[model samples]
Every structure is written in C-alpha cells, then in structure tokens.
Target: MRTVLHGRPLAARPRRQLRDHGDVHQDRLAATFADRCEPYRGYGAGAFTILRKIRQGTPWKEAAGSAFNGQGSCGNGAAMRIAPLGAYFADDPKTVTTQAIRASEVTHQHPEGVMGGLAVAHAAAVAAKARLTGTPPPDLLGSVLDHLEDSFVRKGIEKARRIQTAEEAAYVLGNGSRVTAQDTVPFTLWVAARHLGDYRAAITTCVQAGGDVDTTAAIVGGIIATPPREWRDEREPLPDWVRR
Candidate 1:
C-alpha cells in the first residue's frame, strides 16, 4: 500500500519521485520494511537477513545482493508485497514491469526472485484494469505469462493454465511448499485467476491448499479482492504511517 501511494505519484511527477536516471529511490522503501518487518516472526530467512543488512546501514542494492552468500534470494518475499505497485500502474504495462523490477531489487536480486515480483505485479495490473473496465479478463494467466521470460516461475504458471482445480494446482505447482518464487507465485495466481470476483472463495482456496497459506493468501488477496470491513476489523490495524 505504501509503495502504491509513493509510486503512483511518480507516474505523473517522475522528477520528484524518481532519481535522475528514472529509477525508484530505495531509501524510503528500505525504511518502510525496516520499520515493519520483524526479524523472526513470519518473515523468511532471506528477508530477515536483507532487512538486517538495511538496518545496519548497508546500501540497499548491496544488502539485497549479499543475501545467500552472494547468490541473492530467490524467495517469494518480493512477489508477496508487489501487487499494489502493479495496481497503481495498471494502465501502464511498461511502467508496471520496470517499477516492479526496481521494487523487487531492493530486497530480492536473484533473477527468479525478481521475475516472481514481475509476474505478480503484471497480474495485478491486468486485474485492476479489468475491474476498471468492468470486464473480466478472458485469460489472466496468459497475459501474465506473455510478459515473462522463461523461468521456473513461468513454467509453473504455464502448468497452472492447464490445471483445473486448486488441489491440482497446489500439487502440480508446489503450493509455496518450498517458499521459493517457483513454488508460490503460480499457485497464488491460479487462485486469483479462478476467483477474481469472489474474495472469500479465493482466500479459502489458498488456505485449503495448505503450504505457506499466509503468503499465498496474501498474494492472492492483494490481486483479486479487498477485505470486508469485518475482516479488516478482526486484524491489527495498519500502522498509522501507512497511507490508506
């Protein structure tokens, strides 16, 4: 949500929000994550390490790239938080892709990790556009796959396109079981594509799939639906600093 609020304005006023070379400034994003992400709670090990590096005053790029002994992280962390950025730039596919890459690189530098963010962002962008147009997309996953290059994530999505049930998708696509982008994004996208108009059903399906349920539900929820008022009231409120 913060990324969307911060980044949406950048579309109209790039000079104000972006650096001279047109890249997103990572300082604010890093600070946001540092303040909100607890070390050992629900965050993955890669995310914990990257956030620790940022808090230690390491440069954002260096901090992200240093994870996993320089191999960088290929975890689903980036994809999980990127849907809002996608929705914010829903009308601009190019910006969606570019900005999603920039945002993911702040915490996930591995190509697969970055691609995971790109895929989810692109899916959200498409979903938002469909909502605005009041027309359901005929091929949501197809559009997302079109924007991606060959990767395990892409392959999983390709398989998702063929699968018919959430159970099958979780089985064939790995259901966030490995907690990698390859294991998570495809299954979430599959759920979102199936229940684009039914938020409750979408979330229920995610939970039933059973691996990394929270992350999968978060990703799917971010793309397809907003929580009901009662649902929102049941959870801890957003930080005051978070813009609605």
Candidate 2:
C-alpha cells in the first residue's frame, strides 16, 4: 500500500517512474524496511536467496541470473510482490501489464516469471476496476484472462474457471508447490476471482491449499484486497514488518 501511495507523486509518468520505484522499493524493503522493525524469522527461499546476493554485493541482474542454473528464476516472487502496482494503474490493464514487465525484469528475467507478474498485475487491475464499477466476482477471472498472452498461464487460468472451489483450484491449477510462476499465478487468480468480495475467504483458501502458503497467500491477498470490499477483522493482520 505504501508503494502505491509513494507512487502517487510520480503519477505524471507512472509507467516509467513506477518501474524505477519498484527497484528502489525492493532494495529498501529488503534492507532498511526490515531493520526498522522487530526481527522477522519466517523463511522464503526466493527472498533469502535474493537478499543474500544483494548483501554480498551482487547486482540484481547477476543475482537473479545466478538462480536456476543461469536460466534465471521463474518463481512467483515477481507476481507475489506486484499487485499494488497493478492497483495503482487500475484504470488501464495495458499499462498494468506493461509496467509489470518492467518490475519483473529487475529480479525475474524468465518468460514465465514475467508472465506471472503480468497475470497478477492484470488481475489486480481488473479487480480494482471491478470494485469501482461494482463488477461481480464471476467476471473477474475471465476479464483478466482476456488480456494475458502466455499460453501456459492462459491454459491454467482457463482451467481455473472450470474449478468449482478453492480445493479444486489447488488440485487442478496447483498451489505453488513447484515454486514456479506457472504453478502459482493461475490458482492465486482463481481464488482471487472466486472471493473478490470476500477478502477473508480468499486468504483462507491460500492457507488451506498447503504449499508455498506464504507466496500463494500473498498473491491472493494482494489481488483480492485491491478493490474496496468488506475486510473482516477476523482475518489476521499481516506482520508489522510487512505493512511497514
């Protein structure tokens, strides 16, 4: 949320400015952002690996390139962190998708990684727009799918639409157990679409799915939380460090 708010000043050329903001925001988040708060102990391999490289003086490009045997990481890390940017450009899916690419390229260089970022950003944009227009949940996933170009991600989303429940979505669309974008974004979108108006339910689905729970939950929470909706207090708040 702070990222989007920080972006408000750069609204004049958000497409270009926000892209740089993403890189700066990431460094800040991994550095000072964590230090100012109480120590956080939960582990996420993608985050730990990136932070380790950054601490060792590796450039973002080199650090990212070193992942997955130089093919670069195809993890959902890009998608997991991109939703707020999407909401910032909620009025334009094209802009959302384009800017998402810029953000993803900083750390996620692979096609699947970029695609996952685009899918989440596009979905978040659509969801934000839906909140403004009172668009229903049923239309959300389909609307996002229309703007996506990757066949593998598209196929997963297409299958997501056929799924009748969150459990089914995890089963058929995957739950990020593979740690790849292809296995994560589609199911996150499915839960976001299914529970667009119910933030609690969306997070619940992620938690219940049982694999890479944090990333899946983060992706779902980011997209589903974008649009104005009733946020039940019953849902546990994210750690102060996360919000900070």
Candidate 3:
C-alpha cells in the first residue's frame, strides 16, 4: 500500500484559487468543488481551478481542457479532478460518463485523460445506480472499457494484464501522482475493479496503496459511494457545501 506523504505534489488544490477568469457556465458546480471538496475525495487542485473558472463563467472547453500547452492530455489532472461528476450522476452511468468527460475537458484536454475520468466516473455512477436499482450491471470492468473513448486508458488496462494485486498494478500502472492520465488512471481502475462492490474496503485499500491520495480517493469514492448493493453504511457525508 502506498502510504500518505506530506508536502507531496499530489496535493489537493485550494478553493481560493477559483479565479474569476476561468469558465462561466457550470462555474457554480465547479466552484463548489473548489469551495467544499477535500482536494482528494473532493475536487482536486487542478480540478478546483477549472471548476472556479466554470463558476466564474468560463466555458467548459476553455477553462483548461482545451489542448493545454498544445500537448493535449498531458496530465492526470483530468482523472484527478473528476469525482463529483460521478456523484451527480450516481443514478445514471451513461449520463455520468457524458458529464464527467464534459467536466474533465475543463482542464484535461487529452482524449486519454478525458477517457480516464470517464471510465472511473462512469464506473462509479454505474455502481451507485446498480445498488439503488438492484440490477447490478454486468462485468464492472467490461462496462467501463465499453464506455471509454480514449485508447490510452485502454492500453494501460492491457498493461495491467500481468498485475495480480492492486499493489502490483500500482507498480505498473501508476497512481496519477505523476499527473498523467496514462500514469494514474490504470491503477485506479485496477483497484476499483478488484473491489467492485465493497466501497469502504476499496477506499481504504487504495489509501493504503497510496500514490495520489486525493485523486485515488475521489476515484474510489465515486465507486464505493455508489455500489451495486445498498449495503448498510454510515460515514462522513460528501458535504453539501459543494454546489453553493
């Protein structure tokens, strides 16, 4: 398990950075993530920046996701920043994937990065809806793969072929601390896949296998918070402080 590290670049983005120059349409929701999110389980730093821009009235396209620095999909910022999308669409995966990609585009411009967020958020949304509906979707992993539009995230999953445990997958897939969707998304997917239904266990396990705490937590939280069975659970709320 990757233990937590202090002063690591995997730091959560501050809410204060929600600049007025960012986006304009969904700026409110994004800003709420900035204001209320915990960086990890909440909106991440990069994510906060994009959200604030959105709230301050930036279009989702220009806030950050647009061909950033002309590199396109350069950072794990996309995956790191996309948790709330899953929560909002907790009842609908198709909606969750659609919105998450839209949200991820605020900064994570690369198709791979966008795909990473899409896969994770969609998985979480499906998990939540399944538990609520008692239908429990088909193979959790296959479902995620089916929805992802990026080929890179899919390639990373292929890289995970030899990985046995989440830890090994981390060694091969990375935890997104590197800020590249390629580096971070695959590992989160592996961990989430391993613990498809057990949300609590999933979060703790990922925390222990730490790399990017906030991003990993957010990814796993999206999954656990919305699983396929409505198991009895009681813990910290996601805080309605968001979307203010």
Candidate 4:
C-alpha cells in the first residue's frame, strides 16, 4: 500500500509477533486460492483454477475475466492471495510481485486492479526482504504514493494514512464489497502496514474492518507475516498443510 502511494518507510512500525513460519503461510495461501473459488461468480474464481493447473506444470494461458482485452488485467483478488509467494521466495520480491500479477491476469484484466496486485506483491516481497535483513519497515503510505500509478486505488491509499485507525481507512476507502482494486486494495494495504510486524493482529484487524473479510485479512496477513528483521525465528511454525 505505502509503496504504491507514498514510496517511503512506515511511520510507527508495528511490533511483530513471530509465529507459524515455514510452510504454514504457503499452505494457507493455497487454501485461500481454493476458497475464493467457492462462489465462482463469473470471473472471481477462474484465476485460481487456472493457477493450480498451471503450477502443476501445465503451459496454460487465458483467464476467466474481461479487463485487459484478451490480455487480462489487475484485480484486488491477485493482490490479496499473493503473500505466500512472497514468503516462499522470501528474498526476491520482484519475482514474487511478478507472480502476483500473473495470478491476477487469470481473472482481472483491469489495469487498476493489476496495479493493485503489483502494489500488494511488492509490499509482501519487501516485507520478506525486511524479515531476512533485520531492517525496519518504511512508512507504508509514503511508499505506495511513490511507486503505484495514479489511480482510484492510489488515491484511496493516500487517504489511508490520514484515517488514523484501520477501521477508518476501511470505512472511507472500502473493504472490497465491490471487489475492485479501488474499493479494496488501499484498505488492505493500510491494514498490512498497521500490523507490519504482527501477522495475527494484522489479519484480525482486517476482520474487524469487515467487508470481504477473508480477502482483506489475506492481504494483510501476507504483508505482516514477513516483516523487517528475523522475527520468524521467534514465532511458532505454520502447519505444512492448511485445513482449507
């Protein structure tokens, strides 16, 4: 969120609670990937199905949405579920962020939404780098305002910093009830930054913010799960397989 909007460091970096590292985050991501499919509303669920099949080593192309013509586009959905990729890679954020967009193209074709994915992925990737490097996270709003393209999502991200609390950001910007990047991504980024060091807190705060609970939580979880410094070493390990 900050990377796209502000492009600087976080204001008051949140305290991190190291726990459930390793495979837990990745497995949860796979589950979220599947959960988003249950409703399967036209375009919402198609990307994951394609993603799973593709990851299985299939050279697949074509998605289930209409945003970037036939090329597909950006959507908050891509931004939301990409944390596991960031964590899995842990060091190479660009690769993970790229993968996040690829995940988005399977469904969203909208440029704004695609940009949302990129922003979220970049945050996650950066978070991973911070976790490994022991560097404190930057001011999130500044980061987003600086990196992300000027769009509805970008505007909303700027608003997030002013809103003080996470609840306020979600209320004013959006909690993703509409599912567009404009409606959801900014708030998700806010939540991620607000809880940068604490994975569980970040996710719970998303739930408190309401609207698109899982999606918002997932986005926040992805960002906070990996924060600046080697916090993971202090946390509990995640399960190899998620109940999802």
List runs of model 3 lying over 4 Å from the truth.
Answer: 1-60, 63-68, 72-74, 80-84, 87-94, 135-138, 226-240
Please write out the lDDT profile of model 2 over residues 166-228, one tens digit for every residue. 778888989999988999999999888878888767877888998877778778877877433
Stronger candidate by lDDT (1 vs 4): 1
Ranking by TM-score: 1, 2, 3, 4
Candidate 3, residues 128-168: lDDT per residue as tens digits?
Answer: 66777787666666767777664878888767655788777
CA displacement after TM-score superposition, residue 136 of candidate 3 (Å): 4.6
Candidate 3 displacement at residue 60 in angstroms: 5.5
Q: How do the residues 174-233 of candidate 4 rate in per-residue lDDT, one tens digit apiece?
A: 997887778888888887777777776776787787787766765776677644345445
Question: CA shift at 73, candidate 1, in angstroms?
Answer: 0.6
Give lDDT tens digits, candidate 1, residues 109-170.
99999999899999999899999999999999999998999999999999999999888998
Clashing residue pairs, backbone N/CA/C < 3 A, model 1: none
* Local accuracy by lDDT, each model: 0.79, 0.70, 0.60, 0.58
Q: What is the TM-score of each candidate against the true structure?
A: 0.87, 0.75, 0.66, 0.63
Off by over 4 Å in 4: 1-62, 65-74, 87-99, 226-244
Overall local distance difference test of candidate 1: 0.79
Q: How far out, in Å, is residue 92 in model 3?
A: 5.1
Error of 4 at 56 (Å): 16
**For model 3, where is the 10-residue window of minimal lDDT?**
7-16
Error of 3 at 51 (Å): 6.6
CA RMSD per model (angstroms): 5.0, 6.0, 7.0, 9.8
